[model samples]
Target: MFYAHNFSYKTASKSLPGAPDLDEEDSLEDAVVVFFHVEAGDEDNRKGCIQKFVKNTKWLCGKFATKSVLLHSFNHLSGSKSSPEFARGVLDEAVERLERAGYTVKTTPFGYFNEFSIHVAGDSLAKVFKEF
Candidate 1:
């Protein structure tokens, strides 16, 4: 399996069931964060990707399956702090996709400025990439 121990993602499964890659630290409140990419592509491909993502993510939301969900997309990640305008455009789509997937999805943005982020707490590990 392809692995990268040095990768930047830090995980904690005891808390979020699925051990989602967190974008922020745990608070007194219970929540997990996952930042995903929307990779460069055509409009049709992009829309299709979002649809498929929503479909699969819906399956992930099977157990802990609360209304809580979030979505973030980055065409490219240079740095988190320098891209508020991009966030401003796709943030709504993120919220919308989660809500459509049976999640209550918070309208509040996750993480510090420019950092593309999503909040998930378990029930989504099924969607993360796997190595054969």
Candidate 2:
């Protein structure tokens, strides 16, 4: 799994689940908004992926001084993406772990394309990329 995150003052995303009328907007403030791409090879060891995800997320949060996170499934970062089911599992586990750590976490619905907008803080540590 790979993640590209930005510390944003505000962010918003609308689900593009293919039904025009079904679009729903989700927004957050003072959050580390993460765009995650699950690679096809990461399905081999789910537990390891989850651990790495948590560690990397912790680092990101500490470095950016944010306690909130928004997870967005984004396969565009990699060419060898995992299946939707597998990707969802990783993302769900990550959310669970973060929540247990007492961070406010929100996730856009899985299995849907989304359109997002974010206002980044432009700090050097505000943008981070991690591979897990």
Candidate 3:
């Protein structure tokens, strides 16, 4: 499903920022893909980036194990005011969480960009989830 305005940062799809990629029903070696698509009219689109990311990370920590990897993308169609600061803040937070979970990550797309993706080792994800 897709939305255009004022979408929720957290969703049931598990497409949060730096969301671990888990096969769910399959092996952990595969990746889990989370797609966040917001319409142009959506409010708080800027903040949504970070919010979604955080939500995804929390979900990963709580519900998933290490064998899963997360691939996240916060996207909006043409229009609206998504800024670079939003992306930076979201990325910074995501990196922090990923690091804490023993996963290394990166970000891209300068100045009011689009989305981001996260990759973690199966061993690392498994290791992190081992605690839970």
Candidate 4:
């Protein structure tokens, strides 16, 4: 599952103990925020799945013309979720790919609940959702 939003502002309000420390004290602006879920079935085509996800993310970023991206693991979208370890690895790989392509990437704390404050763009293209 994939859901993305072009945001003018976004910040993590609160996170669990294990969540990574935020590098930026202020809210991030001009970015695409992606909420994705990995299902257990995806394990059959892990590499290809990740590549498609990354490509779609880049496509959305291009539509918004932003080099910044935020990835959040959201399992609430479906019942058949992948193992947390594997899901996290996927996020990590996506981050590496995006960074290699010159996009600044940020991830919310994995395996934890976070409260985020976001101001999404008014343009219709700012919101995108897909399932694969």
In lDDT terms, which candidate is top? Answer: 4
- Kindly list the per-residue Cα lDDT of model 1 for residues 1-132, writing each as its tens digit: 011111122222222233334544322122223345443342335455555655554554453343444443332344333234434444566568776655665422333334222333333342365211
Which predicted model would earn the best TM-score?
4
Give me candidate 4's TM-score against the actual structure: 0.80
Lowest lDDT sum, 10 consecutive residues, model 2, at 1-10
Residue-pair clashes per prediction, in order, are: 3, 0, 13, 0
Give me the runs in candidate 2 sitting further than 4 Å from their true place.
Answer: 1-21
Q: Encode model 3's per-residue lDDT on 1-132: one tens digit a residue.
A: 111111112223342345554322211223323343334333355465556555555555444443233433445443553343454455566557666766533232222233232343344342331110
Candidate 4 local lDDT, residue 25: 29
Residues 1-132, candidate 4: write the lDDT tens digits. Answer: 122343322335433355455533234677888889999998888898799889989998898787888888887568898877788888999999999999999877675555666777777777788677
Each model's C-alpha lDDT?
Answer: 0.39, 0.71, 0.39, 0.75
Model 2 TM-score? 0.79
TM-score of 1: 0.44
Residues 16-94, model 2: lDDT tens digits:
3442344456677767777788899898988898898878877777876777888878875578988877888898889
lDDT of 1 at 48: 56
TM-score of each: 0.44, 0.79, 0.37, 0.80
The residue ranges of model 1 lying beyond 4 angstroms of the native Cα positions read 1-32, 42-44, 73-91, 107-127, 130-132
Candidate 3: residue 22 Cα off by (Å):
28
Model 3 misses residue 24 by how many Å? 28
